[model samples]
Target chain A: AQSVTQLDSQVPVFEEAPVELRCNYSSSVSVYLFWYVQYPNQGLQLLLKYLSGSTLVKGINGFEAEFNKSQTSFHLRKPSVHISDTAEYFCAVSKGNTGFQKLVFGTGTRLLVSP
Target chain B: DAGITQSPRHKVTETGTPVTLRCHQTENHRYMYWYRQDPGHGLRLIHYSYGVKDTDKGEVSDGYSVSRSKTEDFLLTLESATSSQTSVYFCAINTAQGREETQYFGPGTRLLVL
Candidate 1:
């Protein structure tokens, strides 16, 4: 079985400041990791994903996440943030053997970009 | 969008009433899933279908029942509306075999059970 834990429930950052939203997962099998973003009253949009190979993966809106096997973490980061970036973020994973498509998600992290 | 559309956009109902939400898709990707979004819980899968008449339970499937009679339509029914079930519902589609399962979601249906 696979489960995810989002360390922070909320993160507030000033505009143009760097921010990181931490995520950790537990799974005995190989897994694919992903990050998604949701704006107010809107559906979720895929930010990025890590399938294989690289530990560092870049995503839309200048967002990125690093897949650290040792920490069992895939923390999302952005070097600089904008007020428009305020939204809810989710981290999800799917087992590799079963299929890299069916996802199990973390609770959530609410990003508040303040100017 | 992945050609996904959820019906009624927003609904308000009282407890004990039966309500059904419809999800329509034009993508024909084969995998359709129903998920609920809450304040703290990002998104929890209620049910998913691999193909017509093929369905499976997901993490939070107890109060929800799903059916897919055709490729383009998937339905989610709430037998008895409850305040606990009040949340935004999202329908997603994934072409797992080809696109590697990055799902595209619908706008969502906001149901308020009072």
Candidate 2:
């Protein structure tokens, strides 16, 4: 079985400051990782994904994450944040090399970028 | 944004009533999924369909029943609405030809069971 854990339930950051949302997963087999963002009243949008090569994956709105296999982690980062970036960010994983379509999601980290 | 539309964007239904939520896609994608979002729980998968008439249950499929009669349509029916079923329902599609494509989500349907 595959599972994901996002330690931070809520993160408060001032505008223009960098922030990181921590995520870790546990799986016995090869996996796929993903980040999704949900704005107020909107459905989730794919931020980025890690399928194979390149430990570092870049996503929309200047967001990026690194895949650390040894650590079993995929942490999302943004050098500078904007108030518009305030949203709930979710980290997820799928088992094996398929679409990882049947995803197991984390509890989520609400990034509150204050102006 | 992948030509996905979730009907009855908002609804208030009573207990014991049957409700069906419709998901229509214009992109002709082969996969469709239904998920419900609740406070602090993130999105829980209710059901998924890889093709017409081919459906599978997900982690939270106990109260949900789904059907896909055509390539462009997938429906989720709540046999009996309950307060616990009140949630924001989303429909997503996987369009990537090879891998599980990044899911493109519909606007979402807000159902309030009172």
Candidate 3:
């Protein structure tokens, strides 16, 4: 079985300030990690994914995450955030060998950006 | 944006009534999935289909039944709707091109059981 944990339920930041949302996972086998963003009253959209590549993976909207295998962490980061960036972010993991993709997602972290 | 659409984007029904949600895809993807989203539990898989008439249960399949009669259509049904079953439902398709696999989602259907 695989599971994901997002420690922060909510993160508050001022406009133009940097932000980081923490995520950790537990899996018996190797895993693939992903970040998704959901705006109010909308479906989730993929931010980025860490398949089998360099630790650092860059995503749209100038967001990035680093995959730390030893630590079992894939934290999303942004140099600066805008009010429009306020949304719920989710971290998901899938077993690499499953053949079919079955995603297990974290509770979610609400990013609240203010002026 | 994988050409996925869920019917009855918003539905309201009473408890004990039966409800069926439809998920349609324009592409002939072999794999399709259904999920439910709540406040604390990000999203939980309800059911999935690998091919026409080939369906499997997911983590939260206790109160849900699914059927896939065609490659582009999947249906999820609640035999008896309950208040606890009220949540946002999403449909996804696995677009696996070679080794790159990603699930594209539908806009979602919000169900309210009173």
Q: Which one is best on lDDT? A: 3
lDDT of 2 by residue, B57-107 (tens): 989998899999999999999999999999999999886846546777899
After superposition, the stretches of candidate 3 with alpha carbons farther than 4 Å from their true spots are: A97-99
Q: What share of the true interface contacts does candidate 2 keep?
A: 0.52
The recovered share of true contacts, given per candidate in order, is 0.57, 0.52, 0.48
Sort the predicted structures by lDDT, highest score first: 3, 2, 1
Error of 2 at A45 (Å): 0.6
lDDT of each residue in A1-115, candidate 3, tens digit only: 9999999999999999999999999999999999999999998899999999699999999999999999999999999999999999999999852346899999999999999
Over B9-107, each residue of candidate 3 has an lDDT whose tens digit, in order, gives: 999999999999999999899889999999999999999999999999999999899999889999999999999999999999888768788887899
Once model 3 is optimally superposed onto the true structure by TM-score, how far is the C-alpha of residue B47 displaced, in angstroms?
0.4
- Assess each prediction's global lDDT (C-alpha) against the native: 0.90, 0.91, 0.94
Q: Which stretches of candidate 2 lie over 4 Å from their true place?
A: A96-100, B97-100
lDDT (Cα, tens digit) per residue for candidate 1, span A1-115: 9899998999999999999999999999888999999999899898999988899999999999999999999999999999999999999998742322578889899999999
DockQ for every model comes to: 0.57, 0.59, 0.62
